[model samples]
Target: MYHIPNKYYYRLHQIRPRFKNDVENVLIYMATCLSNLSEMPSDKFAKAMNNAIKLFPGNANKKDKTINNWRTEISALFGLIETDSINQTSKPSNLAFKLSENQDLVEFFKYFLFYFQYPGGYLKPHEILDYINQGILFKPVSYLINVLQEGEKITEGRFYIDKAETTHCIFNDLRVTRQNNPRKPKNTAYLVIHNRKNNINYNWTGDVIRYAGDILDYMVIADLLVCHGNKFYLNNKNQEVIVSFIENEVIFLDYIPLYKKLNLNINDVKSLNDAWFYFVNSKLDQEIFKTDLYKYLGVDSTTYQDLVLDSINEFESKLEQGVEIKTKEIGDFGEGLVLGHEKMRIKRGKREDLLHLIQKIPTQFAVGYDIQSVEFDERKRYIEVKTTISNKKINFFSFHLTPNEWNTAESLKDRYYVYRLAISKINRELHLIQDPVGLYKSNKITMSPKDGADITFTEESSQKEKLLLWID
Candidate 1:
């Protein structure tokens, strides 16, 4: 019989870390120290943990208990590394490699936090958390997310949780501690965490609050929650992640094979990775991942369409958020600025009446440029606008050019103009690039080896235009 594992936790040892950075510093240290070593011995693991403390800001001199918790609770529990007792060795997960030096902590958490859950093997080593009882386990993160996203409609969401309420939900909420509370709203299976045995140590109240708070802080760092004081507001910008919590939270894998993989000691990072690849009848589970949750979506659970549809929807939702919308807005604004500037330049010319020819092309057309305008010489100038919003001053400018756009620019040569707009609240400026393809061919502009085009300017690099009265 398995234990009722509805548990969330953090270190309760001497040095209690309330910040995500503390965890980051530890991981960063270990990733660097262990990068070359595939299998780390126990003694080396201990040494790494000790050095990790010194790496933390202010050098708090945390020792003994904190190091142990860092290894068992945070590191293994969070799936950063796995232990191999049979071989007397431990090794870092793929995540550690990604986070090996200068990784952005929040972006790391976005991928990492998916593995964070209450009832997983993370709590298996802790006596209090792994307290034995045979019952169906619940994932606290998903239940809480539903309360945050659709709370007003659901019974639990109807109640806003402050510190006291959060404590209540963790410790005393019967809906979580018991299987079926009459008070639990109809058709809501999420609130049921486990069946109450009346033997659970209620003295875990203080520890429960600390652990629950830590989980909330994790969500905040992952940009899923905006925590103001003790209350949390859903960060609507990351609805993609929230809906993810709604979607994938239900499928519980058969960790039995994983237990065998590590002799029931290591948390099994491989198992977590395997869970995502159910397409080939993954080693952990033989059947489908789509569960009763699919009923609400009106999908025929018997079909293969679920996986394909799920993927497409995820990509589409991600595109609708953050950079895509704002990029379009900035691109439009930048093109408008350059169009006005071009009109002003051509105003006094004999072909001033040719202003009608200067028009902004809709970006969706993908005609390889943004605007059709004229130089003072009335040359047919194909203007491609690349815009970025930076509130601070910087020396360099960078942007992405699609293959089609790059080809068109190369063909047009000097007849093509690139209006690189950097807009801020107080200033709007344009660095004009005529024949960017020629500049690159001659090694005049810096084209980065990475994702986008990078340009650093000198006197001969580009023509600068100062824009004014643009905001009003």
Candidate 2:
């Protein structure tokens, strides 16, 4: 004679959540008990149902209806229990002990890793993503259970993982409902589940395995790969396996932070090619592309093509794109004048970035000018700019630098009037340059390699002279 357990029903009510498979799992478990209880006396089954209802949260409000429904279902199943002859003595739980064992879970985790490594397969690692996805049962189970028991009405909570704050909440709309909550920015409940599930004391040891695998993947794609002695800086962080993979001395930590902390001098570069070679071959501990072989022996530049170069180029491109005009018109100026002002504004932003790169000044919005005019106090340099949509290649001053600019330059150390014009022809771009002396210099200004390879008098010219400014 078997009867349903109140604990199973209580767990079932907790599982009827809006997300995950908890509700379905509970139903399956309940079905098993239902089949067994059918053989028991009707009064005993009724008593079991009463006990189950008592554990539910709303039991007081709907006790009569709930109890009546259970009695009716038991009555209906009594005939089947008597005639169907099903034995549930050996099936106390819906899931088998072996199925729920840690060993089985550990095996599943391995399969998951294999699938992530090779995703075309059916049982991909993301199947375990529920363990990480936001707003699901079994996610932050410990945290949720604790909060519920504390009567905290937690509605919102957060946990720190890998240096990022991730939120945990029961209601999906809790984010919206609790918008004023302090943890809104780091409101990622998805990762909370990931950490919680991973910390489970199951037989599975997939947490460390997956963490190591992910770190290895990132390290392999690093821009300036380095491996100093284990005591060195690169692998200095907690990631031990990755530290073991590198040969020679390891820097012991990630690059940017280490670079900043060590205050490494990335200055006084002569040529981009030379600087890149030095960084890769020596400091970065990476293999350098054979520039000599490529130039004289006609070899492929495959060695030069790497993730580091690609990422660098992409970053530079983004900084370039940031120079575009966001606001169209300010006050009653024609399109030509308005665009010129915007161009100067964007150019000023680029100048600020350069200053930060050189560690000269941290402020991006330090200098300002009203309308199309600016005055440099150092040299008493007064500049008045005029712009045109035309493509004519006249003396640069003909566009913005009037004859008066020449007189102003006499008192200024480096007085400059910049003419910016859009060349509407195909393959033509906007032209801009500083006409300080109203003449081009005899020799180009050289830049250090660490300052970045491409240096231009103006943003437009910088793009044109991409190869000329690299300092080795």
Candidate 3:
């Protein structure tokens, strides 16, 4: 019941010349019977074939011979083999014949079966091309359809081309084909371009613009061009523009519009915007985007490693004024300062084990708390530090607390404190915010949830109570 293309029959004849007469009918019947099934029993398969022959009367009389011949021909030609075994009753026994280990042939038959079952439906040519590229098909089925041929007449209607508006570019050969009814308003029209050139170095900006103009006269079109391992588009000015097509523009322009039209939240837009920026700029390649442990251990696996190593040789140059330190090193130094401050404040009797008890969980398990310190009264202080190399005067210190950390802060109540440290070339400043969850609940602070972290604001808080303590 499936429409088998003439090319499939031609190819089958070329592959198996002996079973040329039986291939088409037998394959179609086999594929249709096995379409909804992973494996079919011998008795059930025989019954299905008998029913299929009655439907197609040409092979009705040779039902038994045809079924036996097809089982052998299918295995030999299409790599579908039957497994058989002798039963204890000494009667003839057979197991289900499954598709062979040949993945390409199996995929082809699967596609062919689907197409056969669904007779009339729109199947995109690019989808077929994808199948070919993915090894589902042996060859380009689109090419065999004769649709991509140059100057091929596609129906009775003629596609008018304006001579005066045509660009003097050689690659701009546009062909428009209309389906069946030319006079109908909703008639489907396909825009096909025949690129017969070998040299791809030449600029096709003018050609693209001309094609767009030609297509626009008949229909609205969004064009995509793949060239030189990059995607390009013609802007409003007819200028060729290269963009991170798949990463940024395509998803942003196509998908985000639908999301916005549906009235989605601002968080969705913000997340998508961040993702697009990160993808376009290749942010993952930088050391800052690497694992926090990698940065904490000063593991430089980037191209900047050699430059940093060379800088180490120039000790005087390294010690020069205005020399910036890495963010991780600044963070570690801040933790050291906090540890020293805690060590000095703790009772003299417990001073020996103060550093050990500080925990420094970031290096160990990357837990919510960075350091566990003891107050003057011997009470535990759970401290999470946020460090920045930027000057406190010009930049506002921002800290991110994970959901786990937020829950920890809520559970610990007054014992939880966030230390925001700003390190400049000459001086270091630390600001502490204690009982942050209580502060937020009392409307003393504001926060935004981003990427599984609560981005709490310090300067943006509208609290009358100033809980910030300046650590000397």
Cα deviation of 46, candidate 1, in Å: 3.4
Per-residue alpha-carbon lDDT of candidate 2 for residues 1-472, written as tens digits (9 for 90 to 100): 1111332211101111221112222222233234333335445655665564343333456657655654343222111122112331111111212112211111121111211211111112243122113211221222222222232122243222221111112222233212122223233344344445566321223332232223222232221112222111222221232222222222212222322233232221111212221222222111121111112112235523432253345346647867433222111112223233333443454542322112111113322211233322212222332322211221121222223344443334244433333321121233434443433343332221211111123453322211111111
Q: List the residue pairs that clash in candidate 3.
A: none
Top candidate on lDDT is 1
In angstroms, give how far residue 290 of model 1 lies from its true place: 24
Per-candidate Cα RMSD to the true structure, in Å, reads 13.5, 31.4, 25.3
Tens digits of per-residue lDDT for model 3, 1-472: 1122332221111123234334333443344333323335555655554564443425556657665655544433343323222221111111112111111111233222212100011122333222222222211111111221211244333222221112211112111111111211111112222121232132335333343233221111111111122222221121121122111211123222422244344343333322222222222122221113222223336523533443354334535744554444445645654554555455344555554565444443556777898765567899887654321121333456778788888899989988766543233556777878888888766655543344445554422122221132
Q: Report how far off residue 268 is in candidate 1 (Å).
A: 15
Identify the candidate with maximal TM-score. 1
Evaluate residue 270 in candidate 3 and report its C-alpha lDDT on the 0 to 100 scale: 34
Task: List per-prediction Cα lDDT, in the order shown.
Answer: 0.51, 0.26, 0.36
Better of 1 and 3 by TM-score: 1
Error of 2 at 248 (Å): 84
Query: Which prediction has more favorable TM-score, 1 or 2?
Result: 1
Residue 233's lDDT in candidate 2: 20
Ranking by TM-score: 1, 3, 2
Judge candidate 1 at residue 97 and give its lDDT: 54
Give the clash count for each candidate: 1, 24, 0
